[model samples]
Target: MKPSIVLVGRPNVGKSTLFNRLTRTRDALVADIPGLTRDRHYGHGRLGSKPYLVIDTGGFEPLAKDGIMYQMARQAQQAIDEADVVILVVDGRSGVSALDKEIANRLRHANRPVLVAVNKSEGMQHGLVVADFHELGLGEPVAISAAHGEGVRVLIELALEGYPEPGDGEPAEGDSIRVAIVGRPNVGKSTMINALLGEDRVIAFDQPGTTRDAIDVDFERAGRKYTLVDTAGLRRRGKVFETIEKFSVIKTLQAIEEAQVVILVLDARQEIGDQDAHIAAFIRESGRALVVAVNKWDGLDSYVREQIKGALDNQLTFIDFARFHYVSALQGQGLEPLFHSVDAAYKAATINLSTPQLTRTLIDAVARQAPPRNGLFRPKLRYAHQGGRNPPLIVIHGNALDKIPESYRRYLEHLFREVFKLQGTPLRIQFNVSSNPFADKQAPREKRRERKTTDKAKPASGSPARPRSAGKVAAAVKTKRPSGGR
Candidate 1:
């Protein structure tokens, strides 16, 4: 394992900006807004060939007792505990403040190597603002500008200076199924992760948006490796009040897209809302396998459970294919079945189908429900084959395939889902309409020539021709009559 570095500071200290620079990616959301990052965000960084792990944490407020600030403080402490080194970032332009001193005092007791990075120090001389940070007594502060890319390398090198070397370890497991747990705020997503992992790996609180960054925790269960991502609570667009929350929402959505399976945890206490359905629709549209986990089931009575089920059916009607599990994360109930469903859903989403089998299934489906006619023509459905996976795309190549009605398409989807046992994953059916090569092959000039030749064809055998002498005799008689009596 590479050395891990944690960035800790008060709010608006350019920690995120510096994190983006070190990771060489814009993965961590960066804006001018303060407190934009309310959780610990992890990324991989490299200085030349030296690769290391870096964590961007929320602003430090060790004394915050209640509300989201206290939660953020606790999350930062956890990151610091796991870090090989901690870098305290302070605003150079603003100089050292009481908060900086407080953070420095806290770090001194952390018993780990702590380095100070005085950010936004581009125009100032080398030691101008560095001296102001010396009162914190951690170390000589490295003057740098995270935005202008100055002194960042020196800061990272200092952080990694005393770290022990890595051993000859094998690479991490690559075949683990990435499961992202998402839901509205305070729906026990973190609690679910802790339950599954059998530890408090993530900070769980009753507050909304406690998790601002998508955190991936890897573990082994039943001899199979799994990575569970704990994401921020995704509120509806109109209800998202903070810029940092907006960034967190984006990160959550991205986590959904990247994961192999998504477990949408719903609060059993609340009524199924439109936001829940909206999230389900997104998961369905992303083509990822879905498992609806109705969390906090231990407290619900039979009647309440039935009502929640009814609401789910009414609100999320489009996602009925997703398997539902009533799991209580707090008490660790029903998780085994939930994971079983997840495994099945992942398998269904990625299963391969033979062309012959797909064609046969298509034929059977058409027979069961005859395709509706397009005007006067009944579309001749042709061959079907596997087009792709992760939603298992099946492409049907036929003439006039575009004329396939939406209702018939739904029928085919339902049929495919039933025949292939693709209940927990979305199935896609695409139509590739092929045109006939001979239908418009004749040229206009050729058609005209053919018409003329047919019109001027010789008379049938033995058919008599008109007499030319009869016309001459008629003309001669008319001329003599006109000269004599006309």
Candidate 2:
């Protein structure tokens, strides 16, 4: 497994900006406004063959040390407990504040490998201002410009120096199916893992906080290789106010990142809430396989199941590719369907179709529905190729790739699954646009050219250019061309 790292800093200190730059994605919401990032966001990170998870945390404050902002501070402090390495980002333009000093002091007590980043130092003049941050006693600080992406490669290399993946000297490890059992606290995360292992693999408790570590247990089901990770149950900030449970939050976020297939376990009686949706967003953002399992599903009626799925469909609008199954870990009533959904999500991750078939499907999907627009450029996904497995990566080359909203992407994903029969597995759809969508439009241009030529060739005398209405155009097309031509 890859190591995990956390980037912590005060509000408006460029932590989220650095997160977007490192992850090469706008996964964290960025705005000129401060405190836009209310919760923790984690991203996939790598540098020169080393892969680690990076986390973007909420802002920290000095006056509100015991307040909500301080709760966020405690969360960042937990980053040290869970991370193999820690990155402390500070705004160089603002100089060093007392809050930064407090975070540095906390990290120093944790005794972990820490890297300090002085952000917003793009110009030569800011060098002197950034140099003052070295006084924090954490060696030379790396000056970076997160928005313009300056000095990020060096910062990533420095962050990964302590986190090299273990090599077995053989062909890379065979794809061991990763199953992340995730849900709200005390919802049987430990109970399911213990049942799977047939031993006391984790602490089974009615009280929350029974499991803090993201315990990964590798075993075989029949002949299939599997890794079942029981992550710490997630609790609301209102629930855990202390400084110590911060580590649990970090582990939970990292576990969501590392898992290949997330078994999003839901409490059968409870309606899914913001926390469940929050975790589902992690799986969706990570582009991993998703299987929505309604845990403790025994002794329920058809009406209840329908209510559950309906609630799920409404809340899980973003994850159109995920398959849902109601299950009881205690009785194992619906596990086969759940596992089958897992198998489908796994296949969806690596599902490959002939390029001809995919291109044809692209034609059909776009013909049925035009590409979603981003200003003038309609972000057209021209072609796609399946690149990776474990979680399938379909790289789509297009125009205005950044404008392809998550909803349109899901529309294409739904079409691909419906047309090609991709079941169960979570798949990643990557978009890249080379040219402007407006420039390469053929049908509109052809029609304009044809109309211009027709107008020029019209017997240019008193044959008045009477504009044709919709009904007139239809009637003329029917009369002039039996097959419905202009």
**Per-candidate local distance difference test:** 0.85, 0.76
387-459: candidate 2 lDDT, tens digit per residue? 6664555677766778777888888878877877776555567776686457668888999999999988887
Best by lDDT: 1
Candidate 1 structure quality by residue, lDDT tens digits, 406-462:
999999898889988997888889999887777676687689999999867766666
Candidate 1, position 211, lDDT: 90
Question: What ranges in model 1 sit over 4 Å off?
Answer: 1-174, 443-486
- Which prediction has the highest TM-score against the true structure? 2
Least accurate stretch of 10 residues (summed lDDT) in model 2? Answer: 164-173
Candidate 2 stretches with Cα past 4 Å from truth are 1-3, 9-52, 56-73, 90-106, 120-122, 125-127, 130-135, 146-149, 162-175, 242-244, 363-384, 395-411, 428-486
Compared with the true structure, model 2 gives a TM-score of 0.72
